[model samples]
Target: MDTLLSAPILFFMLGSIIALAGARIPFPEGFDKALAAYLLVAIGLKGGVALTTADTATVLPLLLTAGLISLLMPLLGFALLRSAVGLDRVNAAAVAAHYGSVSLVTFVTATKVLESSGVPFGGHMVAALAIMEGPAIITGLLLAGATGVTAVAAGAGGGTMSMPIDDGRDEGRDEERGGSLREAVREAAFNGSVLLLAGSLLVGLVIGKPGLEKLSGLFVAPWDGALSLFLLGMGYLATSRLREAASLSARLIAFGLVMPLLGAVIGLAAASALGLGLGDAVLMVTLCASASYIAVPAALRHALPTADPGLSLPLCLGISFPFNILVGIPLYVAMSRALLG
Candidate 1:
């Protein structure tokens, strides 16, 4: 309970409350975008710097594990969502990819808490971020394609599924009628958030630590301040949007809350098998446990356009992300120690 009421969650709550009260506090949308960009750059640069400090030998095995987690966890998430919820394959797969992927902010917050607590973890986990981000995204596209087929099969006779009519159609008409699912898949993959994050990471890595050191003040110094302001705006936005969500679907909420715990267990067990130390184990578990808001939501907008954002966003950012950061991290830490000891 003490963990639940910790400073981080309290700060988040304060943001939520002020937003719910309908205070017309002006936060420029451009400022939010700038803040997001700064955060991605700062975190990516920090990750790259930390990677530069890691031993290549140790980094390789951990990198392999991170890559494996990125590849496999999405399938696990997809199965769970398919069995637990009635979500169609595309939406389930999209949401599954998200659950398996890491949330950069949540990971950053966990790192801050661990540092404050004087817990030790490897710098190599930063590389894990780079490893995991792309695979889940690619998997999500495949899942969407699979779901589109399922949709077509299910709606075959419902009048929604259209067949290419063959009333002596011309070659141009035939070509026009035969649209492929690859196009939808491509659209989802090349989204704004994925491109921004991938681009920022590349820039941060190519620029390296020296380039980042020159601008640490704006990116590093005021990071917490920017986060606070961003959260404040987000809290207001969530509250305003979620007023109608009190009666929202409970099944989805439960899924959002529980999946992180499951993911943490899988990640922690993998860490133990690989002989990861306490700090790395905690972070690995945290990464598995965390879900993406920025990347997945954007992908889902393109992929699962019919999926309820009001239901999805608040469940992810408002409920699950905060729950994991505030309470789940400390709990996972304690549990990892007990189990792995």
Candidate 2:
């Protein structure tokens, strides 16, 4: 509870409340994105600076574990969504991919809390963040394509996927495939947020402690205050968009809440096996618990055309993201303390 009373989190709550009351968001256009970019750069720099002293030997195993966890989540989410949640396979795979991916803001918030509490964790976790994005995305696309079909209806949000018509000519198909490959490359490589995170991390790694000395005022000191404003905006965005998904089924709504806890459990258990300390274990759980609104949605917009952002975004942003921000992180930290201690 004390954790929730922090200035940044209080700002998030205030944003959600104001949004619920239907107040107009005061932040200018692109401000929210700028905040996000600021956060990624700050965290990436810190991660890089801390990583200067990290044991190279342990980094590889931790990174490999992150990848393995990312791979498992979408598969698990797909199975649950299909059998229990009753979503069609196309939507199921897309949402599953989202579950597999990490949310940068959520991870950043968790780290802030850990830092405040004086908990110790490895800097390699940020590298783990960068490493975890791609596999789940590819896995989701394959699962959708396994049906060998996609059919878009006449109107927006009309329906889910349909079988693709078989064509004799392979020429145009090759061109289309080539274009999709290029699109995939952009999503993986050129996403502005992820690129900046990686680039900033590399800069930190190169600059090391000397860089930290020069930049602490800009990046480190103001982090929480900046995050407060950022989450304030995010709270509004998440709430305002809830109306778009008001028609969602109760089971799907439940899944949005339940999936994160399920994921946190898996990630925490995995971290335990890998001998992670309490703080990193909590973060690992937080990473698995988070659903990617940015990267997966971008890829799904292209890869699974018929997959509804109306559905996926609400589930992720409206439900899971807030849940992680307000309740889930605290719960994971407590769980880590109990288990790890």
Best by lDDT: 2
Identify the candidate with maximal TM-score: 2
Estimated TM-score per prediction? 0.79, 0.93
List where candidate 1 sits over 4 angstroms from the true fold. Answer: 1-8, 147-213, 238-247, 303-311
| lDDT score, candidate 2, position 102 | 91
lDDT of 1 by residue, 1-341 (tens): 55445455566677778876767657665887887777666676666666666778777988888878877788877887788767766567767778867887777767766666688777678768656765676676566554323222222222132333445644543332233234343544575655565566566667778977887887777876776666666655556555644655677778878989998998888888878888888888899898877766664454344444555566677667767866788888887889776
TM-score of structure candidate 1: 0.79
Count clashes in each candidate, considering only residues at least 3 apart in sequence or on different chains: 0, 1
Give all candidates' CA lDDT scores: 0.68, 0.83
- State model 2's lDDT: 0.83
lDDT of candidate 2 over 1-341, digit per residue (tens) = 87798877888888888989988877788888888888989888988998999988888888999998887789989998999989887789889999999999899889989988999898889989987876788778767666545433335444455455666634554454445545654686677777888888898898998988799999988988999998888888778766665778888988999999999999889889888999889989999999998988886676567777778899899889989999999999998998898
**Which window of 10 residues has the lowest lDDT sum in candidate 1?**
150-159
